[model samples]
Target: MNPVRKRRLVITLLILGAVAVATALSIFALQRNMTYLYSPSEVDAGKAPAAHPFRLGGIVKEGSVHRVPDTLTTEFVITDRFQSIPVTYTGILPDLFRVGQSTITTGSMVNGRFVATKVLAKHDATYMPPQVAQAIAKAKEAHRIPKAAQGGGAP
Candidate 1:
């Protein structure tokens, strides 16, 4: 084997190795930042991560919003029309936050309650965040009645 060719092959291998290491590190960093989104039903089923922060999306349950006077803390329940999860936030809420509103809150679950660090409310009646809409749709599909159960049997 020629000396020049041997050195060229070594350099090529080093470049490829560096690329692989960089790609692996990039993915690891991104995983730390990635937050999974879950619906109320999923949370009820114990599918939410115990310690890691995640996004919870659904409609704010009617008459569930509670505020403590002279404090920034608030509590509410979010429901996908199938199940509900209580959420607590100790910060100023968005002006758009209200009962019967579609919302997405980011935080971790603790003792059966979601401790939210950020709460995002839908801006308009006709518009829901895409993730929240998808979660609600999924929950509805999961709980839909079967055709046979609905008395639509085959002929």
Candidate 2:
């Protein structure tokens, strides 16, 4: 082969290889950092990862909040009206956090309860996280469909 052609081919191969490697690394890093969102019902149905951190979203159940005296620790139950999951947090909660409000907690499941490291509350009465809203919509749609027609209802 001519030396000029051979050199050009080698350079092209090197550039392509570098790009492939960079793309692969970026994809792996993103996969590692991504966390999923799940509702209380999904968590209850074993859809959430137990060890990896994930975002849990639902409305705070009324009369389910308990705070420790003179401490930041608090316990509450979040619900989607169909299922509820208890959550524990020891950090400062957002000022908007309260019963009957929508919230998203980032944490891992331990001993049947979610241990949250960060808590996020909706900023306005009408605001809700998009993932949470989507999950709620899916739940509502599932319930609206007849069980027989779904093939998993009454048999």
Candidate 3:
């Protein structure tokens, strides 16, 4: 090959390699920062990542909210009607956070309990996060179906 052509080929290959490396690094960073949402039942069934932070979505179980006197730490149970997970938060909770309200908490499971880093509550009585709604709907549907129909019985 001519000297000029060889140099051009090398430069093009270097540019392509750099682009590929940049793309791979971008993907890795995004994946590390991404957190997935899971329902109470999914967490109960061990579907949520045990070591990574994730969002837990469901209704706050009625009468489950508890706060330590003179402290910001609060504990509550989040339920999808079929299953429940206990969550603890140490920061100032949202004004809308209350029993029977839909909420999503970002945290990681520690010793079978969710230790939340942040908590988000629905802005209105009629509004729920789409992911939370879908998760609850799926749990409800699964509860309505019988074990036999769900292929859980003996053949």
Candidate 4:
């Protein structure tokens, strides 16, 4: 091959190889860390992966909020219309996590209870995060999620 043509072919092959490696690395990194958000109903339906780290969100069931006797730990129930999961957290809970309020707990469920490593509560009396509200709205549209009783009546 002509000298210049040989050099051009080498450079082209090197650039193609670099692109291939980058694509592979991107896929590998993506597969290493993946977590899904679930609602109480989704967890109950076995949609969540067992032993996989995941997050759950729902309203704190009425009368289900309680602090441990002498610890930063607290226990509560997250419920949607279809299901409820008991959550335990060993940290200061957000002030807005009162009965009938919304909160999200991050952890895994073990032996029928949600063992939360961290819990975040909504700050306002009537606030739902936009992403969560959208999920709820979509669920509502599907008519696939049950409507829970709220304020003594069906929501």
Worst 10 residues of 2 by lDDT: 146-155
lDDT of each: 0.85, 0.87, 0.87, 0.82
- Cα lDDT of candidate 1 equals 0.85
lDDT of 4 at 27: 78
Candidate 2's residue-wise lDDT over 21-102, tens digit each? 9999998889835644789988889878776889999999999999988998999998999999899999888988998889
**Candidate 4 local lDDT, residue 34:** 50
Which sequence of candidate numbers ranks them by lDDT, best first? 3, 2, 1, 4
Mark the 10 consecutive residues where model 4 has the least summed lDDT.
Answer: 146-155
Give the Å shift of residue 4 in candidate 4: 36
Candidate 3 local lDDT, 66-114, one digit each (tens):
9988998999999999999999999988888888888999999888899
User: Over the stretch 1-155, how does candidate 1's per-residue lDDT look in tens digits?
Assistant: 89999999999999999999999999898984564578998887877777688899999999898997899999999999999999999997788888888899999888888999999987654666888888877656655655334432221
Clashes of each: 0, 0, 0, 0
Error of 4 at 41 (Å): 0.9
* Candidate 2: residue 21 Cα off by (Å): 24
Per-residue lDDT tens digits of candidate 4, residues 34-111? 544689888888888796878998889888888889898888889986899998889877766688777888999888
Q: Candidate 3: worst 10 consecutive residues by lDDT?
A: 146-155
